[model samples]
Target: MFHPDRPGPTRTNLAIRTDPDQPSDTDPPSDPDRPSDPDPPSVVMRTDPDRPNEDLIKYGWPEDIWFHVDKLSSAHVYLRLPKGKSIEDIPPEVLVDCAQLVKNNSIQGCKMNNINVVYTPWANLKKTGDMDVGQIGFFRQKEVKVVAVEKKVNEVVNRLEKTKVERFPDLAAEKESRDREERNEKKAQLQDQKKKEKEEQRMRKEMEELKSYTALMKGENMTTNEVRTQNINQYILINN
Candidate 1:
């Protein structure tokens, strides 16, 4: 049983620990090609940083870089190596942070195992959005594994039972039917609007064509009347 009040063997707090395989803090590796400090430390960012006592973050000597249980939980772990520490010198606390986060967030009593742990250049970690007041980031080594743990299913069943008790099946069905009817009505209205617009456009075009034809006939009639008048005047002049 994982208890919040009591810290168990599985629940390790963020007290600093030493790992023999880690590099010396004084002489961390540095990259010559990069102008900025080559060995930036890895960090795990969380929405809440002031969240007292949990897996929050783990930082240690470059050689001691570590992460928590691999692939089991949502643990944000990272390493902060000295500028002089080699790429391999990420601290063991990196893994520890990752593991602690997994343990903290997982269903109580279930164990997450075989999670993956990996490392990237500190520069690779990016933060896109504004973090809430206490959030931070981390770095971990390029080593990780997937670990399996038993999960508790009782809570899930209990929730389902509660939902069944509170459900209003009849009311829900009525609402669904009403919603479907409304959608159909809206679709029919849109179709009707389109048909109306097309009919109006057709009528306008027919009206315009009729007007043009009438104007052309009137112009022809006017020209014929003028020719008749000219012939009449010429005949009278000839007869006189």
Candidate 2:
């Protein structure tokens, strides 16, 4: 059943499908305008469709070289190197692969240009989600010139894409939701504790007043039974 402001199972019915065997470079309905690459290279780019503005650049040690289209674009590509390979030893095949991967993901009519390659250590790569809410807050966007690649980052991205999708909302989203729910629960718990404390304090004050009244009656000529009768009558009057 449908309810106002609340979405139904219709939203869940929407599915995102990707072919495991098909390379991410398979153009989205090939544009007749794109020039054919005689020998394509390998490169990596983002697999998500929501955010068109984020990019991940691999830097430092090249164990995890990630590359992507620079701009408000969705292209995440990674270069896998032999365990000890340095960035300087990256082959022409790798460069071509990177270029083809970028060209395939971009707008069909994008002209060829020298794309920027950040030669920093792989440790410098920022793993922020392409769909993250505040990714634009921390990083400045720069014009990235795509370095020509000898291979495509499409295959690596395709393999990891499945795992990423199966894990819903990504890690950041899940953590944020859990933290918020926990905070709300904690606040409610504290309020209950405070209420119980107030009730206890009120009970103690009433008991102390009764003790004082009994001490005063002990000093008077009145008997204990007479004092008890007077206290019961006072209580009834106050309650009524």
Candidate 3:
């Protein structure tokens, strides 16, 4: 039943499996003599190999982009998208970041002059027949071309690019901190307003008392001695 002319299943939306035995760009070489790498870029440490796809399903929407190096070995890379955002809505910076990741994670990618990264929505990535655990297929047939040097240049430009994963929880935390600070400032303003009101009331009360004493002293029924005694007693009371 072996017909050579039929061609094996037409390989549509096909992907190559990254053999576990083979070392990847993601990990450092086993040789102790070599200097150890200071960064881990491709590794998504929060998720295990058993369900690396979970991050895609959980945080990434179906509309989110998935990329692989064309005709070369590459790590499965997904650019996360918000639930309602479409591929068109993806920012240019994110696209640039994903392109760098795809190029860097490919086998001998840095050595190559240039590499083309084909990407598609997760929805377009299908598992029609029985594929390996990490292997998947893409139907969208879209590609973003990148020069290998660009990845190196970007990494050099921003050192944080090494560990920069898709999720940016730090940005969210900073925004939350700003909001809390603003709320605290508003509360402090309210306290200041209350204090000002109290001070105003105290000043008005002193002014009214001074007016009453002046009116009593100005009355014609009081003699000069009586006025003097009244003024001394009023001054003492005010001081007290």
Candidate 4:
């Protein structure tokens, strides 16, 4: 059971743990390429092997990163990244935590050494009706990343275990609601942009008309005040 209370629009009925502690002595050295986050507030999610949940596949958000033991039946672990973050932005320590959790959940993987863990963004997950329950494929195989897990890190597992809580959220409804909100937001943004463009066009037309009136009122163009007034009236009439 994994659960952590993090306020958000979408929630799922999967076991969730949040914000694992930093790596301890048992963990492997951090990757030099990946940056470390000092204050990571991300959520780790996993499905029960005994009771597979397909909703995870169906309702996964774009921000989700999926993890599993390579060529082995293991729990489907997911890392829900924060807004504005991508799969590449996942910290090295967090990657270790997820890989360790997935490895430990596997009956065979837990005992193996130097085995690889495959992960990819949730958007790349491919589901077909022909596939069995709780099974998924990838749209772009190249997008999947592999992480080598030499052994299980008990310290990281223990830290993540402390945050476990069981909660059954309505994954479908949440996804639908989130999708609706996003559509509405995009629609609003488009409307705002159109409104702004129309205002800009109106302003430009006004400025052009004012420039024309100023040109007409110039000493060389205007012989008298009456002529200037006449030109202004004629300009307004033409525009109207």
Candidate 5:
């Protein structure tokens, strides 16, 4: 029931799963069988376990949280968080879902018990030209987190698999487009801010000029003709 259309892109045969029941800080849990809402949280993975997609590592968005089996070969799983949500904000159920998906896709992980899964924000992922395809290092090891999966949960895996959808996306193009849009949006915001400040400054200057003009035109500030005549008469009397 979940569609594969979204902004971020990955390589060919990317598996995406939408969870309608994904809980948020503001919303309650929904029925899993119900259709997914627009822009629902999703989990992404590679369909081919043997071949890891380099585009996924290279072009992943900042919102993506990467997941893999610790010290084992597993499909690279990513959780595409909603806007304003961080990796720490991931709900417990959703975390388990991602962990299970990674475990399920891994040949050795699926057969083992008490496996460990490591995850971190995509921004922490560090890739080098010397590294082999899909190989990645972390910029900060402290940002990485580990979760223990005691055993595979068939219900969760089944639910996710049922909603899995595949799509081929141009990763490079999508990333470039997203970056360009962000830059343009920031530029527009800065322009608007500058315009607003200029307008405010203009109003302040007009207010100051009006105040000065009013002070200059005040009766106390200008000598009247009658006062001038009185002053001359007083001067003549004093001279006489």
Candidate 6:
């Protein structure tokens, strides 16, 4: 259950987290070879980075790099691997950062002076049979002995995340603009209806006036019929 005092998560707020397993805001684009998509995947991070392996499996992609503390229990570190780049192409600085993320995930590593970290492409890893949500089995992976955890894994990941999120256009703003256009159209339709009603009313009044004029003429003819018939020649001569 969510706490009442806690603020709800949103795109902007969800972007913030203490763990490196969460994709970095500064992550580079995966599609460096071609023009990026106009609308790409939006930035979505799990609120809890407690179990990184599970998060990686759920949110991580085949191109992503997986990192863990060598023998100690650790959270999974997912590096957004660049497209068309081999494992050797990864920058040394970025590797050091990933090592730091792995160390941070382990309770023992954080206390020790240094810890060894292992990494492999997510594509190379597979989940064991009926394993827990966050658990995974790695057949083989590259290992690096990182003495000082200069945590930059999150930074590189952040760069890649920015690239992905930028592709998604702001839908809320678009929805508002669409709503305004609809309102304007409805208002114009209503005004046009009012104008048409007024025109119709005017036509009805004109027809009534014409009918009244005919009736008045008929009544006058009826009232004067006897006088006119009695002296038709006199009446015509007088009128002439």
RMSD each, Å: 21.5, 19.3, 15.2, 10.8, 7.3, 17.9
Q: What digit string (tens of lDDT, one per residue) describes model 6 on residues 45-83?
A: 222234332434543454556666666665555565544
What tens-digit string does per-residue lDDT give for candidate 5 at 17-114? 55546643433344555555555565566545556677887888888898888888777788888767898888776788889988897878899999
Considering summed lDDT, which 10 consecutive residues are worst modelled in model 1?
A: 160-169
Encode model 1's per-residue lDDT on 1-240: one tens digit a residue.
011222221222222212212224532343233233233343333211123223222222223333333332233333435445754554443334334443444333234344333444434332234533123234332333333333333433232222211111232354457567778999999999999999999999999999999999999999999999999999999999
Native-vs-model 3 lDDT? 0.49
Better candidate number, 5 or 6, judged by lDDT: 5
TM-score of each: 0.28, 0.32, 0.40, 0.76, 0.79, 0.41
Q: What Cα-based lDDT does every candidate model obtain?
A: 0.40, 0.42, 0.49, 0.75, 0.76, 0.52
Query: Residue 97 error for model 5, in Å?
Result: 1.3
**Deviation in Å, model 1, residue 226 alpha carbon:** 1.6
Q: Which tens-of-lDDT digit does each residue in 103-168 have in candidate 3? A: 665555645755666666767776544554445565544533332333444542242233333332
**Candidates sorted by lDDT, best first:** 5, 4, 6, 3, 2, 1
104-216: candidate 4 lDDT, tens digit per residue: 88767888999999999999988787766666789999999999999888877876665565567787887898789889999999999999999999999999999988887
Worst 10 residues of 3 by lDDT: 10-19
**Global fold similarity of model 5 (TM-score):** 0.79
Instruction: Give residue 118's error in model 2 in angstroms.
Output: 5.4
Best by TM-score: 5
Identify the runs in model 5 with alpha carbons over 4 angstroms from their true place: 1-10, 21-43, 219-222, 225-240
- The C-alpha stretches of model 1 lying farther than 4 A from their native spots are 1-167, 170-175
Residue 58 of model 4 has an lDDT of: 86
Off by over 4 Å in 4: 1-14, 20-41, 219-240
Ranking by TM-score: 5, 4, 6, 3, 2, 1
Q: Give one clash count per candidate, in the order shown.
A: 58, 45, 0, 3, 0, 12
Between candidates 4 and 6, the lDDT winner: 4
